[model samples]
Target: MFQGRRRPWAAVSLFATATCLLAACSNAPPPPVVSEPPPDAPSTTTSAPPEQPMPVEVVVGVDELEGGFNPHALADMSPTSSALADLMLPSVFRPAEDGSLQLDTTLMESAEVVPGTDDFTVRYDIQRQASWSDGAPIAAEDFVYLWEQLRSQPGVAEPAGYRLIEDVASRRGGKTVEVTFERPYPGWRTLFDNLLPAHLLRDAPRGWSTVLDDGYPASGGPFAIRQVDLDRGEIVLERNDRFWGEPARSDRLVLRAVDNARQVEALRSGDSHMALFGADAATMRSLEELGDTVDLINMPRPVTMELLLRPDSRGMSDPGVRGAVTAALDRNRLVEAGTGGRPAGQLPAHAQVLSPSEEAYRPTEPPGAIPPAPDPQRVERLLTEAGYERSAGAWLRDGRPLNLVIAAPFEHESYIAIAETAAEQLRAQGIQATVVTPTGDQLFGDMLAADPRSTGTGGAGSVDMAVAPRPAGGDPASMLASAYGCPGVSPGGETPFPYNAAGFCDRLLQPTIEAGLSGEVPFDKVSDEVESVLWRDAVAVPLYQQAQVLAVRKEVEGVRPGNGFAGPFSTAAQWLGTHADDDGY
Candidate 1:
């Protein structure tokens, strides 16, 4: 449902230009003094005094840091932001754990969509106490400005998630806000992104983007972005003394950047408080040796693998090749490889997507083990019958060679392996396949340029096969829409990933899935219906899903790791412990 969040570290130090008070008068810092009670004071070690609870500082791993920090301009949505969205901005109504829509009363007092119309035409109850970091009263127009800004981010992908809003009107009384839509859309409730400070941003010279991109001076969250120092590699967030809810307790929280290799060095040398995303297995194992020093958080997703069939793909447009290809692929092996150094799978006959939580997933290997037999012999047989046969030890057909070009993004390691596997499988079938590595930006650009309707890698030319992660939601509609929706797949043909690289266009599947997206019908039927179309059309193959693993330090408290997409802090801030909870020891 979302692109997996990956962050590249950049040097950001908030303390470089800080205004810290000098020791004594000038220079000569004050001496460290213990705050021990006077000698006459009674000792309370046996029956400890009720000490006030200290604020917990949570430092979790992020695969990639945020591309942009602004709520309005951020293009790549990260779970950190999704989690921070609660602290930073607020949604009118959010998706709940049970897969139902529920209201967030923090910003708007109340919200309800107009029945029968995709346009929510929602009515908002104002919270007068709500104020931005700059001390300006929160207003409905703040939301209005944010709406226009997000809609005008100057790129096609910018507004893809926000297409439901038709218009917004906040009246003069300053107590209400209304959103009207062009048609019936169920995702409308996701539109009311919590407003940024119109006061601080409105007058900035470089527009809002520059202010937040370079530095944030105003916000409604628990804290405002205080400073960024590139040299020390850190960003500091200071508690907002004016926050409406319980203020964040930490006076200053820092986000540092260190690679997985150096993370162990950072931990051993006492250079870091917590290791972030991109940590390798070796680093984690090393941290385990130190014990109670590092924390890990695991975020779960239903699945993160997708099929790459070109509906408009040439030659492959034939159902036989697609089906034969499906029958040829060893999905179990592919699934196991998707997760880093781990075996994972999603059986075709089952409803569960690779999980220990669901009783239906029976493991063939020991827990957390990838199997060795990927079964290539079975793949060879299927292609032989499809007229693509091995000739002179190479796949060839009708005096021509069976060839394919796969497009893969480097961000996800799985795509890299899948591309290689795809090449191998095609080779076994006597087909020659080439894998192309395109930068993230270039991959999408190439896909957008291709004529989506043309068969065989259709378009201006971009991809043959693309491996993408499809984050599953509680409902099948979430999974189905991402893989089979019309907007997802190009009508013109194969483009590139995130977009239906397969360019599958099933008129029936699209509308039915729409019904589910708009909450018209149950997604279970949508899933059944779409899979049937995929089954008949053989539009795309379903590879195995992915499971994310996070390692938490023992000392970290109230750290419950659940599905963030399901609910903000689903398990966050509840699991209380100190560096002593690293159960392994």
Candidate 2:
């Protein structure tokens, strides 16, 4: 369950320096590379469809009713609002699963940071006739407002590119809006790239500098919020006739709030034309048995779930104790108990967001690297040699009993199972690792960067051991950036700018980190190499990468899932039945 209720979004974004570079220039920090387009979808700018087809209907699970259609706040990538957003408010650019940047062109001519010396200002040439749903001109200030909002809003966790840029200048003389940078970074493109509604939002938040709540304001995307049927737990999106981009083929999209019990029943009932996100394995299989076929979408990511240790802490200061704890546990048991995919090795499950061009990854692993299984018995032996011994049936060393308390998110049961089993294995090795569950903000809330012992083995903001799904789609650079390359605060004071969360800060990892951030190679290869190194260090155990399956009725032709973007399917762009042919499904 790699769900993102972690709500405050933290993305491994593009950064830049003060030098101004041309729009299409590949001069950013990472190597210049275009992400691979989704194999299943086509740009609407391609030749017109042989014959225009009818629309499609789709459904998905949403946490709450969307207050607004803006993706900046409303997290409703569910089928309904997304469909409507596409028609009401379309993004100027969208990324493929591989991190390639592309232009929507339907509403804008071109977009990029003003060229020359490589800086943060993003300038775009707008299409002459671009207008809002209310017929207001879509101007450069719209982009300016977005940058301003991101900077001033405290609750809005803006991604990387936005961090470096200081502000957006007026569109007075030039057709472009100049986005100023506060520092040097490589991720400028990720910002100012997503266009906003100038007319409606300009006056929004009390004169444009205000933080726009998650409310779906007047969208310039494909659709706007039609209704959130609270009684039925359903959300519906009708088309936005004023859409500037390719006209959405679909007129309406719907979403429901569903849990394990209703996932299969909802799809089997044919109540939804499409489903976005997948249910658990048992639920997925049951849907399949009901003659519901699902198209699997791959969202690779770099971040991962892990169990890290603060060796310098009171009892674990000895390497033997660390080894003892490591050796006592059976990784396979944890994976089988909860994780659905194969072993993650060292890479996080979600590293799929990085571009292959980053240097962190290698084209291929050498022979003997990336092995599927390792000897579990060897693990036990290693710990014994580390000086841990049985003391009254519990692992003890230096009279401390080798105790480690692991705090995991109570909501995620699978992770709990892993911790529980790990405790059992540690007991066998004469170590005590007590596992506890926490709900509310106390769980994984404040522990992440807090002092290890102060958090007393960590709590809230931190996870002693966590079982999380990697990014749905990304590259190794993305993974390294989040897990290994973080500037995170830790039990041992703050690490240097690039902190290795897993405590794997060998100077050796520096080269790989630079390589990944440099964007020097195709991401796929970069991922392979980076994964190898991370695995070797045991930064975090790579759990399995489960498939995100969506149940579609046989009658649903062209009901393909999206590879890029988020969620199971970014419904607004997909077509139902014969309509899929129009979108080249």
Candidate 3:
């Protein structure tokens, strides 16, 4: 028989007694007073009832809230989704101020690694009172559901940790959970961050994509979805009365979507209490004009900007050509051009898998003592070695000019600027290059994801290079695998994984990446080797990490900048409105 933590009967009894006393006090009138006042005495003046406090509501302005709300799915990995998840989901572990994982005791009684000889095991003791707003228990089934979907789904945020899970066992009427892993995963804490409700979503019609599309069926955190009005560009979150832990400080939270200028204007005009957006120089200056009424802070976003060279493209097929292209452009220049006077607080990305803001980030040196600065000599030498001769200031191979098409999403201004700058630099270095604007879906899904074996030299509608963003997460192993691993077959074995944007996979390095992800080897042991291989192949040139800005009025209390992954919404539960009394009514 499996022994699990028992509910506190003593505490329950005491709570019952207190509830009975409160009910009696309210429902039963005091025993009839034996002494009657003198008939002639004036009747005692009746005291007036106390005034009720007004509810507090905080309105926040943001860039947009137009993505699917599923936090685990790739298509929903936007700022809006992250913010919503932080406000409505339950997690066993949450990020601390130092970016370390800490057990959320309100949600779990205990969560720790269990002793196992053959396989790794983790035991979770959920709080007895922990339940969703809809009265569903937050238990082992939720963990199992998340693990199953993430490991099998096509476009998940990071499935490496979940893939290592062998089985999830339930006990104590589904309150206790035992998870057995195939290997010793160091990044286990990263799993099940935004656990979905298994009872509601286990058999949804559209599966993972439709999860939280309009509103949550139930909420496990301090706030619940009151309304999601896409047409009105607003999402209203009300305090979850069923929350077992501390209640939200504010009565309601309003997330209002608006443009950058409008976000600043709302904050200035006091229409919104706070605003978080990707601000340009003009917007930053506008916020600065608010003086002491507001405080502006830079918040790190979980994305890195990179110049991806598709190995299957015509100009990039040869390793030498790819190396030459990588050597010809300067990362600093690219960052400058991409930021374009915006106070993005971007740092030149040095590692392929981890962003500069990450705790485990270590700069990877370029191959063969290659300097960080652009080297024209190295570019010329590499191009010549690849059998390309300089003719009339342009490299040509077999009477064909070495022309390349660089693509960027038409909606992303920063990426477009970076692409144009790269084109100018390549043209200056005697390489024929042109910039093309394409929709993000077309650029990423169709152009960059083309398989070399079938495409056969990348015919029409193929881009030789792209300026895009690569998302980073808490788990380094998962980040490495998602960014560079070989294409995986779907659960049905018909569809292929389409997230590997590099289109460059080395057979020798695949084993090392797998070992790191599965915990057969330490991530530190394999990350350096994999990064070296990627640099040698010139898979991509990392430019900088993306960032956002948050401006909060002085009246709003308890709002702080969150970690790079979760943004400001991580502390949403603690946000108090301007009208909140000293008692936080």
Give the whole-model CA lDDT for all candidates, comma-separated. 0.52, 0.49, 0.79
Writing each residue's lDDT as its tens digit, candidate 3 over 1-585 gives 012256799999999999888978796777686898899988988899997766688889987777468877644556788888899899888887777888889899998898755788888999999999889889989999988877766556566677667789999999999999877887888877888898988877765655567767889999988877888898878889999999999988889999988887788888899988878888888889889889988877787888988786667888899888877887778888887656554567878888888888888956553347788999999999999999999999899999989988775677899999999888988999989986654555455655644554433226778887777757788788877887666544576655466777677788898889877888888888888888877888888887778899988899988754667787888899865342221
TM-score of each model, paired residue for residue: 0.66, 0.62, 0.79
Model 3 vs. true fold: TM: 0.79
Candidate order by decreasing TM-score: 3, 1, 2
Highest lDDT among the candidates is held by which one? 3
Backbone clash tally for model 1?
Answer: 50
Candidate 3: misplaced stretches above 4 Å?
1-54, 207-215, 312-315, 328-330, 367-381, 388-413, 416-452, 456-464, 487-499, 518-522, 563-565, 579-585
Ranking by lDDT: 3, 1, 2
Better of 1 and 2 by lDDT: 1
Tell me the lDDT of candidate 1.
0.52
lDDT of 2 by residue, 477-504 (tens): 4444544443333223444222222433
Residue range 1-53, candidate 1, lDDT tens digits:
01224443432233432434332347665668989799999877567689655
